[model samples]
Target chain A: MSNKKNALWHLPLIIIGIIALLPVIFMISNSFKTLQESYQSILSVIPNKPTIDNYTTLNHQVNLVRLVWNTFFMATLVTVGKLFTGLLAAYAFRYYQFKHKNLIYLLFVATIFVPFTIVMIPNYLVIAKLNLLNSVIGVALPQLCDATGIMIFLKTMEKIPGSLFDSLKIDNIPNRRIFFNIVLPILKPSIISVGAMFFINSWNEYVWPTLILKDKSSFTLPLALQNYISSEGGTNFPLAMALSSIMIVVPLIIYLIFQRYILNSISNSGLK
Target chain B: MHNNKKILPFLYLMPTGILLTIFMIIPIIYTFYLSFFDWNLIAPTKDFVGMRNYIEVFTDPVNQKVLMNTFFYIILLLVLNFIVPYVISLVVKFFIKRMQGAYKIIFFIPSLFSLVVGAMIFSWLLNPVSGPVAFLFRESGFVLPNWTNSGGLAIIVICLITNWKVFGYNFILLLTGLGSIPKNIVDATTVDRIPKWRMIWNIVLPMNKSIAIYVLILTIVQGLQYVFTPINVITTGGPYYGSSNVLYHTYLNAFVLYKTGNASALAITTFLIFLVLLYLEIKFVEGRSRYE
Candidate 1:
């Protein structure tokens, strides 16, 4: 009887949780609906007649393929950049002892909390000076190093017994070789979660991309999606939904694939 | 061997060091330096204008409103994005033990999308004309006020949009923190027959306080950022600077209006204010987190 009562307690939370995802459901469902059907059945979740028309319209109108490809490229570049640099920084912090290492690592960690506003203008100027404005590389360049990825890796390394490294040290192996051969395999899961975080963050990043990405073809997913909303006079609901669905699809897939680790490791994983 | 040890570490650090210096460190210092200049982005000559921009930030009535709007964003975001999520995490963790994975994934779904996307979805759903909610209101015989036209309502609409994107991620974060508490300690509360509220207050909250404080500080510091995309997407800080916060205003001043000096001053001032807040949080909250 008591167990049954406890089961009943799940109802309110389940209802609220489903309710929370209403907009997500709405976005997905409406993406399949015709533009007329979308407004005709505003509250209806399931499209009266599912069609790929909206997506085709969106593709031709927004050059969706180019935007998706550019977004994918930028996001991947950032993920790779952050992972590579973050791994090296964390490895050095973990393995080799250097003077003021703790202070330096703390400084790296401190960068995690520096508000975006403080960096926005100056970084923009620097990127422009580099003649990279309105270029996809410009969007990817500034975010190439993430302090949070370093934090996540450091936390992951804390679990690997120090004896493993000590043995490698005794063998006179190069640190680079040991990092590639040993640390890479061991930190795979942490790397994946952190990489997914970087990818998804870059994918969903709006403000910085908004500033740098002025050219239509260069706009990342968020920038492209925002363009749809703002330029359409905010009334092109069906097209926006279709674009949003496309925008969210990558993160959605990432979430499903990494759900277990993403949930478990969010406390340690900070995405700036 | 000893020589290799020191040099190797520096070698490993160089790439990260270079990136951080360009992107984070120098930019911060540059912001402070620019705050003293009367320079436009396109202008050839730069004039030194020591602290005048900072004075303008304080005295300009428009900026005063921006500052006030920023405080409102901070307070409302704390409730929606921070406290509400914390409470929801507790409820889901404790009460909804069954299908916890379902709850976690479902709650976190909204967070998977961008704030710009969230803003777009919500502006439609809550639009006064031909919107689902507005239609419902009309059926009940009243017109819903158009939020985009009104300044206060615009701020609220943006906040709700941020909350939609932020709530689940924060819930998952707090849930993870709560999950780290040893099961035996939680079991002890049940065995003692402690009332639920008291157990939560006397035990659960104290134990989870450190991560909670981190999340709280994140809420305070990130509030403006979370609002940025939404405002930029839909409002443009409109109804005439009604919905703008410090960060957005800073971005606009520098990028949109070419007032680099004013923007830099605003940016540095905002940075220092947040730095002080973070210091206080570390001093007071983390200092007292004995469990940590």
Candidate 2:
């Protein structure tokens, strides 16, 4: 009798889950459909006539290869920059004490609350003044100030045994060697978790890249997609669906493979 | 050698600090300064406008609609993403014991992609002419409106899409929160043969307060900005700028219109509003957790 009660709730779960998956199912199905089929068979869960016409058209029209490459380049640079800055800053906050250390640390933490919109205009102006507009460096430079990663790494670093640090110190080990040899090894998991998050976030970043990158040739996937969407409409549903799939496929695969680490990183820092 | 130790910490902090100071702190301060000036993006000079830009933001009809849209979006997210998802997760946690991992992965799939991509997919699905939802409505003998073209309804449609993309992340967070609740507490209460609803009311809800507040703040933050994707992708904040929120409005003002002064003013106002909401959250919600 009680088992029936438990099983009854599964109805809601199944219903919501189907609703959640509907968009993906629709997008994929629409991507496969030809233009006429997509319009006529709109309610069809499966494409009546599957074709690769949309992808071919998109590839021909907008240099999909270059957009993907630019996105990868920007995301990679931002990830590396965040990792380096996060590790160094976390090391400083965790290992050392200095005058006004609390103040300086507070300054870093305070940026967490300040929305990026507040600073975007001035940063754009600064980039414009330096003539870095339409460049990848300008797109990625301002985003490298990542306080969340520093916070996450520092919190993880705190859990490391104090005795290990003392033992290394007793041997009169140089700071650089200790960081490279011991600290880096111990921080590997966190690095992966944090780095993957940084990578995912950078991949999805839109506003900053849009602001900084103005040239069509230099555009990231998102900027390129935005441009396409604005210029195109429902007449090009298959093309839009195709581009959406391409944009989604990368991060979806990455998340599925490294789901545990991404979830861990988010829950680890996000809740607290 | 002893003096070098005093500066070692500074050396370690230099890279991140320099980046933060240059890109974050200085620009934030510069935003405040820029808000006071009437400057166009291409202009060589900024006229001292005092509080005129701020006054203009409060007085502007477009900004007023932008503010309403932002609030409406946030309320819808709180309902769609928070209240509804929380209930669903509780049911999933307590009753549906089998295939938990599959459920989490399936639900979280939407969040793996960018909001922009999700927006694109949804715009196609919610398309009035040949989209599936409209097709279903038509099959059912009702004419569905063009959602993106409508004024008030566009915000609702955008929120629905935003929730579809985001609720999974929040669902997992709530599931984690539920998981964090001590099993012993629930087991202890169950010995009295108390009803499940009462047990949930007295035990589960109270224990889950902190995570609830965290999710609330997160929802507010995401809601304020999440509409930007759909507004840009699907509507372009058109149909009389119906779906445009403050963030998108600010973007249009600065980048499209080149009204840097107005954009900066709106940005500052948005930040302050966020601060006030955060403060209230801490004061009310965070304070309640102390009794636990």
Q: Write the per-residue lDDT of candidate 1 for residues A193-226, one digit (tens) a residue.
A: 8888788888888888888989887888888787
Worst 10 residues of 1 chain A by lDDT: A263-272
Interface RMSD of 2: 4.1
**How well does chain B match by TM-score in each candidate?**
0.94, 0.91
The lDDT of each candidate is 0.83, 0.80
Residue pair clashes in candidate 2:
none
Best by lDDT: 1
Tell me the tens digit of each residue's lDDT in model 2 across B1-292. Answer: 6787778878878888788888887887888898999888788898999999999888888888888877787888899989988898788776676977777878887876677877777776777876677878998999889776776888888888888888888888888888888898878877988877888888898988877887877787767677788787778787887888888888898889988999999999988887876665556444533211
lDDT per residue for candidate 1 within B53-81, as digits (tens), equals 99999999999999999988888999988
TM-score, candidate 2, is 0.93
Residue B209 Cα positional deviation in candidate 2, in Å, after optimal superposition: 2.6
After superposition of all CA atoms, the RMSD between model 1 and the true structure is 2.6
